[model samples]
Target: MRWRIPLCLLPAALLLGAADEPQLVPDVSQREVEIQYSFTGADLLLFGAIVYPDGRKPDKPADIVVVLKGPEQSIVMREKQKVAGIWVNADTARFRSAPSFYAMASSRPIDKIVDERTAAIYELGVDKLQLSPSSLNDSAELSRFQEGLVDLRNRNGLFVERPGTVEITDGVLYRARLPLSARVIVGDYTAETFLVQNGRVVAAAVRDITVRKSGFEQFMASAAENWPFAYGLVAMALAVGMGWAAGAIARRI
Candidate 1:
């Protein structure tokens, strides 16, 4: 994962702006997730408070949007077309950077909360994800590939979008739940909260969450990564031994 400033801590330049800027205090339910053998899925609760300078809750309603993004990786999307009555790979597009997992929850519909420009800048929705290709391609072709990738990811539960899901309490504290599929990639994840007001982002926060294999899963992962050949050999040997044991038991029976 690339280095990025934590959203909870505002930069000096942004903090110097003016009064009335909403201050955010954000936190996640868990800072780390461990993937075990029986791991099914996980639900992460992101909660935060919006603090004002005067220490008074606002009368006006404020919108909140939370985004959870996993590690970024280069992905090769292939388009299959029928060739001589057989489906074959026809076109391939290599995306320079794409999130392995993405899920969002917002207080209201994104379009209603922020304008298109702000949405695009923040990459609010999965469709608005910035997936630049490694090579130059036709505009129409690139769009098709991009759409296909998003659709594919969404279908696989890697990309998710939920609007009007964030719950606000007393116009200050807000919370949202983000789900992670069992197949979620293991890496560093980011949780971002945006306070939108009048079609613009007023305050933002970012936090890091780690997803990693643990216990037996962790040992296997380490072995495979550090000693691939030995791991493969051991796995093959285990399979052969299991097969032999089963065969012997059957013969005795």
Candidate 2:
């Protein structure tokens, strides 16, 4: 006797077998960004395509989230308090791994797309960032310092969150524009893209970006790094010369 798959179950099995995991094809507008004296800021465009299995578009649309992160740095945050009519440092918190710059953009508000746990896991928003505080063990104190650090960076345009800024076309193509502040440091950066469907991340991709100094800025940065003593001596000499020139001009006038 020959056994065969039931007609009703055959289609389901075929469909399941044919289905493949979705993939992301991501790219950035600029892979190398040069910072110069005239560098004010830049708009980084992250675009990607979602390749579905068998060219089948899902009935439900997927969400796109893009995160541009700079190199991590250790930071110390100090809380200031008014004591005897003067402001003084009160408490301090040190973070071991804090992103020097971080910006996030999403097709919709992150909270609406993913639950808190998922958001925290991926750090989809500024509030979800895991700034590892090295000094504070108290949750409340750590939270306060984290908030303060985020607020300071937000004011400086280093930490940014733009919900509903990502654009998706036909559930296949997605793009987002994130701002790079003038104060961004010269280092390696990463642009990460996440495709979310049914409150789950289905695919993810990453692109690298390099921010570096150019022209005289590059020369100075290299000099400062390679010859710190000479760089300092030159800087002090220039300061003294400028001061002397200014005084002489003033006397002449």
Candidate 3:
């Protein structure tokens, strides 16, 4: 009889313990790298608010400030017989500088997923060609390098200043802000993020985004969207115009 009571309790205990066991799924490949954006809109305005991680936007982004020498920047590529490969400006990090492409992205100190000490920059392609155009190399072989920097600039280099910064606490979780130049030429751009430790780079990620033009902005962006500091000035201008008109009517009265 005592054996029967213990046996009855054993079954209950087994059922209770089973609830804490981990799932023994056959495949684990379903969890892969993924990037998602919240708004499905095209044109990402220069000074507009950027929401990260679609479902979870942080209250404060641990970001970086990247200021570029827009007018002076150039992306060039060449094919050298010695290496027998196309050398892009130097190489393509996908998220860093490429011929005619400049881009930047930041991080949120949220999920313990990002390493903060590394340098992170954004990049995209502007123009590209094979080295068959420049007169510098008269040889037909030099023609390969012709599709170089000149062609990239001719496709329209952006005169932009993307100011951003990166910060992570305990070497994980991040947030950032990326601002494009109001004069940026619309195209497919790649945004990159990185993690570094003690001056050494460790991790890299690349994402593709489009800078489009549409909506009411096709005519002219409100002066505020065109320039960050100019927003205040635009408001002041409207105020001044109203004051002037009010004064003129009062004077006639």
Number of the top candidate by lDDT? 2
Q: Candidate 1 regions off by >4 Å?
A: 1-19, 57-59, 243-253
Q: After the best TM-score superposition of candidate 3, give how far the Cα of residue 153 lies from its true spot, in angstroms.
A: 9.9
Candidate whose TM-score is highest: 2
Q: Give the worst 10-residue stretch by lDDT in candidate 1.
A: 11-20
Provide TM-scores for the models.
0.87, 0.89, 0.30
Q: Please estimate how well model 1 matches the true structure, expressed as its whole-model Cα lDDT.
A: 0.91
Sort by lDDT, best first. 2, 1, 3
Which residue window of length 10 is worst by lDDT in model 2? 14-23
Better of 1 and 2 by TM-score: 2
lDDT of 1 by residue, 1-253 (tens): 8977777667654666645688889999999999999999899999999987778765678899999999998999888999899999988999988999999999999988988888999999997889778864699988888888899888888898999999999899999998998879899999999998778898899999999999998998899999999999999999999999999999999
- Could you give candidate 3's per-residue lDDT for residues 17-44 as a string of tens digits? 6543221111111111112233231222
TM-score of 2: 0.89
Q: Model 2 off-target regions past 4 Å?
A: 1-19
Error of 3 at 162 (Å): 7.8
